[model samples]
Target: MTSEKRSIAVRFFGGAGNYTTVLEECCTHILTSDPTEAALVEWVKSNTKATSTDGIRDRLRFLEALELLEIEPERVRLTETGITWVSQTDPNVLFEQLDATVYGFETALEALQNGPKTDAELGDSIANTHAEVNWNDPSGPAQHRGWLQSLGYVERSDGLNSLTDSGRALARRRTSDSPNFQRQTYYTQADLEKAFDTSFGSYIKGINPRTDDHGELSYIIVKAREDGPYSDELDGERFTYIGEGVPSKGDQTLTGANKALLEQAEGASVPVYFFYQPADRSDLRYEGLVSVADVRYVSADERDRRVYEFTMERLDLEHPTEFETLAASVTAGEREETDSDANDGTNAGSEPEPALTAAEDEYTEVQRRVRSSAFAKRVKSAYDFRCAICDRSRESPAGTVDIEAAHIYPKQENGRDFIRNGLALCRLHHWAFDTGWLAVSDAYRILVADRPELEGYEEFSRLEGAQITVPPAEDEQPHATFLAAHRELHGFESV
Candidate 1:
């Protein structure tokens, strides 16, 4: 393997190895029964952290290959390799990384252990612990608290700001001086796997051998600090400090002078690398660069294939027409719901209202056009560029028949483009599904007609109520009115 490949493998292997050492030590201290029971308990306790003794046996299976320690009914013993590796590895470095990653929950756990705090209290604690203390800037606390919440760390639940288990671990790890504190203190090997997968493990697969400028495959990686209100300070000290890429690129469809203005900003997280793609002259198609979000891993060996190469997770925004449709429907529904609830003395005005400012109007237009170009991309991610309506799959991201997000209700008839209107359908299905000859039932089930044109129609029956895979849900939810209306109006009962 190339040095890059070896490096990638080594990082993954090392993180896993470090976690094993920590698990063994923690387990030994916790379980003192039969050696076998102790081994099992050790494994479970390692994954569960200092919290509870759940899933000890299952977690042991996860780290079985490490063979850090051998267990028998009567005695427990460390393996030769485990002993040597543990002695050599730096516990502090491993733990710090683990704290930021696998043990990220530790931060929250620490807070929870002390008892629940309100959002303001939790935010204050997080700010005090994580945010830079800017003596010149007094508003630092609010800013950092919002940032932590965006990343799914501390959340407000039942009127209190609480740390997730991951958050608790992170908080606890922060107290350690060892760089490897997290390395030796993970909640589970699986959690470590996921972190590495999202942040580094994926780099091993699909990362191109070369980087491109002004190409669809190009990415700009930068470290961004959280500014207040979900905005990114792209140019200042708060700007992203990416190792190999810039904070922003010209080609990404979402590229604005800044994108933090969108409604999605409130929940935005910082210190993440944003990915982008370039579009051609027609502005009709935007080639996708990666299917997953940008991962953070330091590549070693510049000449090695794995070094500096990267891929991204897929993100498909709903079609503009559909987005407009959904936005309108949501607005209308909110109005109706509000009016109905108004008579009952309840204030139904808690939701954020969509403002139709000039900038927002421009954003609306941009989102619409880009949604179409992003169609093929949406399908690629759903099943590696396969037709969800038809079991067609392709290894090549560009080789498949382009699938589009089909709307159950026609936009012309006032159907919204929310996720419910969005379906990853092949070109043929897009046409047939839109024409109302084929309809979806009120229960969100698919129904095909008994047409002489489509022979061996067992295919249609198989698709009824078949769950349609989609990109990660992005606030937009599937609405029932459109599907119900289509079926009722068409008299097909399946619409």
Candidate 2:
């Protein structure tokens, strides 16, 4: 088999770098009984970590391409070739078949056997054999080079390319399998931090890690700002953000960055990290290893452009205590400066706010005002100063929003001032939530109390069954116990 044949086979398999596992699973299911497309899709969703139907469909298409499974109008069934492929004990043979069918491998082997050649040279040499591929097309050559490197058939050094020992052996037909070949593995946040040992920005710019032919892991740095496209909130356990469409840069489309980010989230083989820096602070305060929890794309500034409304959950890890401390200090300093300015007749004509009555007093005794400020800043910063419930964020004259951090469990009821214990909400939603007119289910769905007073308000009624915005991290989610206690107290049924 030649590289061109291998390339065709790879394309037939939907251009997936790793199809053996998916094939095995698909074959096993169909072997027992023919399953409907919906059934198979549901099975993939339930059994595997795949979160979308599109991903499952892609795998099914790959199986179909390889003649491993035949898709009828109603159901899918395995073919003889698929059964044989599934029963094979060694995957090396399957890999060999793929190598023989692919297009660039032969050119790579030949070039390496003679002398070292750059990716362009190899691509040009291969282009002579394939009429469809143009060597001048940057993407085609880049992809060929990438595929060769990923298979361990080529090595690059000092802007020059050469063959590895495995590459040489592969070229000489000494072995069907490359000695250096191994499947890509997921890396934890600690693993990445140790590997880079630098600021998140620097790491992202310097190194873009890719597994197989999938896209590179995008290292996005979100600077917390009022009236920005996204807002982020962090509890000790998780970091959450709602991102809108990124603005276009020069000739770039508005949704370009957002689309890429969403793809990274959806197709990511490894966990992605989000490093958030406060607008008022210099250092990145939160570093969270995250996964895409949800995605909803909507029309943005232009008719063609779309904004990605999404959420990310933080992996379980220790809180960055030092970062939190630094953030708190910055908040305190800002508050002091604001207070000083106010005292210096900055608001001379403004009326003094009415004091809270004894009966209406909340957080006066249980939560220290200064400590609460820090908590509010952290929570609001995480959510980008937006209301988590309504997504209502507006910049004030002072370049801040009117959002307030409402405790999920009240401080007076022994709820500590923790990031997980709070939610950034608009005034109305916060008041309604605190007064038991609104409550959240354990699943984060909004539950309205059966009250006559709330019936006429269309806004409140419309939100009756909607889910509240929640932190992406499982640990940062509103505690079930807290929600249950609130529901029980308000005479609502448990979720």
Candidate 3:
């Protein structure tokens, strides 16, 4: 649409720009604010390390030519495209625009497709096609290289420029005859592998939990769709994620990818990057960083097993990682620990510190409480706020209910907070279950202790062989595992 009006008149900085950092910062400043041309320069001088406004002008002109900025007699502002880019800072949007609008982008990419080349080779290839951009022999190509490196499309080492994984994908797309130009196909697995320095082979479609070459925790790549039986859902700002599962008969425990995600909820410092595609679609579109908000082990109807469900709070970060377009997403460095310098007079420095810092310990506790609350809510909802034994439902005009959530296996015995391991009970039944005077058979039949002295035995004996109420969803039903554990512990196994 902007073809006739736009031209390659704006040339960018020459060589690997030392001012690239300042250039990016200045670009963000311009995109986020409304500043006149003169004011833009002054803002850069006051906010950044640049002594001169030369760098700011160069950045502005480059952005303008890319159609990311709109200039007028009255005021200057970012275009629609520029607003989207600044919001996520996704470099893919910017680079794709450049490849189409800018003259040398495609040429440089094509030249590098053959092999590694010096700036001279890249410049000459571009000059042969579009000769308008030049000051001297290498000026055109050097500027091209500077822009490429800044966008993370190409890298220069040992005086030669090579296409990064991001650049190669762009190059392939430019030369390919395939017309599948969907957004998710922007970057492939190679780009993700190179971005985090992670060398995991062949990622499974949904979740790939991995460690880096340093044998340290890296990241978890979750490829999901928006809506389906098992698709991940973005609920407001928190992403609801279901863990990986198997087709086996038994329940899915917290292991493998499930365990990897649990580590973060336990206060492990690792980033969880989310990507999504349409249902039954290939490839993925990158979303941003997410912090583990809560985790729970529960049954999924489709999988017919208890899997980990993670509640991840999306994070808005200033720095995105080096992956194509996702650079607007995030990049995290490994945390450094140094306590060797703290040597007390007793030489107690030989001992290791506690696993978590105070803040992390507090966060873990918070997650535990959140999981407990979720379990209780689900159990109460499943039983309709009625006791499984007495079926007594208490409700007030204020919407308060008298139902209590009890753990069948007991939390004091290190039992996990799981829906199937929980029961909704009135105060009387809750006390009886905890006292081993009342229990549920593996068949879900209520059992009353034969002890004649028991207070509720006469009333409970009426419904001894009757089935308890359960949730409509089969997965929400209390599992036989928890039932058997309760029965055995209470010496009601023969009942």
Candidate 4:
């Protein structure tokens, strides 16, 4: 208890600088060669010139005041707020940056979905190719690239660049939010195989087959052209032998250099697609072939341009492939078991699924809910689609108006998981509400009485008397009974 008091005292006196110093020490101590309290103390002493235990405790309390350090027994760690501060200095600025990175991420992802690119290639491949990045300024693309790399959105591969899955997910979210772009870029069969340098079924789709001359034709699955068996015109009928292994694995289907060449040669941007045909050795067995193609470029810079001439009719969709059948069967079985359990209440106390599976399921559910068209547009409507805290609107380019549905009584707290228990909050308001620094009252007004720093925030000051955005229908108001119960449960006054 003495140690705890001493630590709090130090944190109380610490300023932002001291907080930074202590945080650096904690990170270097926790993440480096040594992990000991003595080592951490020595590191802090070097920065603050404090020797005695009392001096260290004083500095630590100061750091706590700055919100940079979290104290545990014999160890210190940086809080999420601290990490955000250290990374970008201002949480609001960092959030904006994250949003911008997400936008740029969408543009790059379209290219990646079409084909692979080097870092330089992706920067060039941005859809707004004509716009120049303010390289003379530090707050520019170069800086943003570093930020993206730090956040695990973009990655380096053999001097080339690629998008991580999280990056793709973010891009999809941004794309779904905006309607300017049609479909994310598509790739040809040959290009698709070349980009990944590995084969995976999930990433490949939209195959188109074509033939080369001399009756020595090749198949262009989407944009990927594959050399097929040689053929000759006989009696106006062409007899051809679709050769096996026309495309060797080592072929350079699409390269950064290749994309650059196309950009220069065309004098206009072209959508890219990775293309490939199956690796079937037998001539007759090429019937049920699959390939991956992404549509990245559209002709004439118009939304209505012919992106692809082929549709489902041109492609063979009658036969389900081996992988397709297997996946379908597994999904069917799982659904059956889920339904059976739901009805009979069987296995009521069964152990939970594996951690990885559970996490994946949760992540998938979150993504699904967030990306749904109706939910994406209306989530903000519950709060009148404006920020319950900041009231920022989509009209302001710098400010985001989109709001996410947030829990008032946390879902984990046995709060009813319904709209009445939820508030449509902008990202900033969402963070503040979730952190317990602010909350809504039973009267549907904002409250920050316990949080002095936040109490004077614009939302609380100017908007206190303003009713939060209510549902269009009167019946859609938060359940009065639930609100009463919640206020009673939390010891909050009705007003």
Specify the highest-TM-score model's number. 3
* Alpha-carbon runs more than 4 Å astray in model 4: 1-378, 381-384, 388-391, 395-400, 414-417, 451-463, 481-491
Top candidate, metric lDDT: 3
**Which digits, one per residue and each the tens of the lDDT, describe model 2 over residues 121-185?**
77677777675644355445545555455454566776567776545645554322211111123
State in Å the error of residue 478, model 4: 2.2
Question: lDDT per prediction?
Answer: 0.38, 0.54, 0.64, 0.40
Residue 340's lDDT within candidate 1 is 46
Model 3, range 37-67, lDDT digits (tens) per residue?
8887677668655565777576666677777
TM-score of each: 0.29, 0.27, 0.38, 0.26
lDDT of 1 by residue, 1-495 (tens): 011110000111112214344454544443343355555565544544433344444444323333444545566555554454356543332333223432112334455658776545544454455444321233432333333443334566566666544345345445532112121132232342353233433322111221234532222222222322123223322222222223232112222212221111211111112322212221111221112222223323333212121222322322112222333334444454435433543355553222111122323443333332243233344444445456454322212135455555655654443343456666666676776546665444567666646654665656656655444553233344555666666667534
- The order by descending lDDT is 3, 2, 4, 1
Q: Sorted on TM-score, highest at the top, how do the candidates line up?
A: 3, 1, 2, 4
- Model 3's lDDT to the true fold? 0.64
lDDT of 4 by residue, 1-495 (tens): 122111001221134213333444455554443334555567667756456876766655545444555665566666565566666543232323344323344455566656557656655655254244422222233333444555445566576656555555444444442112112233443444454343435443233222234542132222222332212111111111121112232222233333332221211111122223334421111222222111122221223331211111111222222223222333343354335433553366652221111122422332222222222233345557666556655532212234566656565554433344556677676776666546566566665534446554655455444555556654345545454444555555676
Scored by Cα lDDT, where does model 2 land?
0.54
